[model samples]
Target: MSAATNRGGAAIGRISDLNPVEAGAVLYLRLWSDGAPGRAEMARDFAIALGADGGRSALAILDQIFGLCALHGRRPLIRHGSGCVCLGADENCFAQMIAAAAEGEHDDALMMALLIVRPDLAPALVALSEQFGLMLRRMAGRCAAPAVVH
Candidate 1:
């Protein structure tokens, strides 16, 4: 059986059913939860990898990373910013912001993560993002295990 068939086997449906946060959770559960690495770890690792490649920006790596997540059924958080903070870039840029924020303190990271999807006030952004990620992790955690290969 193919990877999807062995796992869930319904990529489109899963992608359509979730908002970005939910989709991210599922992807996290499927990929990182099994020792792939946590958000910060992945960010740092990617940073190192990108740096070694020469001339590659963190934003580019984030774009590819988020794209990979989406291809595997993850949805990207949409964002809009104020003033210069708003590069008016694509979802990948916003994702890089989140990844950057993830490198900060826990609470700060949560806030940064949320901003990817909701680019409004700063106060609520962190709390909401934290809550959303928690819920997704828990939900995805339930589905992390593979079926018995009897």
Candidate 2:
């Protein structure tokens, strides 16, 4: 689902440009896990949804991940900070995420990004992402996964 679908709306391409620390954190956390084969798309969608709060920089990073995976068939590196993880997407720079860690929890990657970029948004973003992911899964008729997370 698109981020637009997750919430009611957003500012369209008005996200903040990432500072180096924020960029590094976003990329590292996203690429920190072993994502499912089709996960990057979810990562992108989730990021877009979260972008409603996080802005364009988040969208930029997630879009990059989506482009890398959806187009290049490359897995996003979700553990590159430790081993180059990109959430089943490409390894390009600039990234984003927030909210979702199995119910009432913050997704680690999203948490990391929020901490680096917008710490105030961490809590809300996680809750929204989790709720949105659950809603999307149900609407799509898939079994609910553990989280709206990567």
Candidate 3:
């Protein structure tokens, strides 16, 4: 099932289909896994969510989304000081991020959480991607896997 549907019922809607903040968080995490999402990407995502008339609220929401994910134990997703984050990392980094998140510095805790959860999420995301591939095949579309990640 899609991540959204896994939470409950089918996801019925558009990009706005998700809870704004939660959607932002998932997007940020996914993008971060690929590469650091720069200002342009952030601007585009926010613009789409907030509208042609966007403002600091979008920025603030993005920050909070990452922050909350960190708080909830996903900090290991970010590489320390490298500014390049990942969906996974070494055990030490994972441990530290968890500790930081537990202590309340959620914003700084995302990297570790990512590392810690990688073993679990990796398989699930992979399975989902495989399912997507099957769907694409049935539709006679090319399945472009996202860069053979990790």
Candidate 4:
């Protein structure tokens, strides 16, 4: 079965769908947006991994994405609470779309953009989403250190 498929041979449709990189992105975004108690620590870790400037820029892009979603009444269905780590289908979709957009898939980029913004603004959102996706990828790569056996 492909990484995108589940045990039942159906397409994975939720953030619980764990491909390591996408899982990391989903966790980061969830903590970043859901008022979780871990938010500050995760942000600090992200900053450490990407440096202050890159972290700030990446976070700004996230803010813009969320802002546009709200502005356009298409807010992503994120299911997180103060300490919950559960994943949502919408969050998975966003992570996948952002990753594809960052990979220069123009159709995915445009479709993702159109999900939250007007056509005139889709181009700009696509660029921002691409940047955000790249940052997420970098964070996942840098932070996935091998575990030490005791």
In candidate 1, list every pair of residues with a backbone clash. Answer: 111-126
Poorly placed runs, candidate 1 (over 4 Å): 1-104, 107-120, 146-150
TM-score of 1: 0.29
- Cα lDDT tens digits, model 4, 1-150, are 343333222234544556665676566666766555556766686689789888777777877876776676344344444344455555556666677776889687687667556777777777877888788778777767888999
The CA lDDT at 5 in model 1 is: 34
**Local distance difference test scores for all models:** 0.38, 0.37, 0.38, 0.66
How does model 2 fare in lDDT? 0.37
Weakest ten-residue segment in model 2 by summed lDDT: 6-15
Give the winner by TM-score: 1 or 2.
1
3 against 4, candidate with superior TM-score: 4
Backbone clash tally (model 2): 32
- State residue 65's C-alpha deviation in candidate 2, in Å: 16
Evaluate residue 90 in candidate 4 and report its C-alpha lDDT on the 0 to 100 scale. Answer: 57
Candidate 1, position 19, lDDT: 44
Q: Considering every candidate listed, which one attains the maximal lDDT? A: 4
Candidate 3 residue-wise lDDT, 1-150, digit = tens: 455323322223233333323233334444544445555575665455445444345455445434443554333333222232222223233333433443444545543344434444433323322332222232222222445756
Q: Which one wins by TM-score: 2 or 4? A: 4
Steric collisions counted per model: 1, 32, 14, 0
45: Cα error in model 2, Å: 12
Question: Residue 109 error for model 3, in Å?
Answer: 19
- TM-score ranking of the models: 4, 1, 3, 2
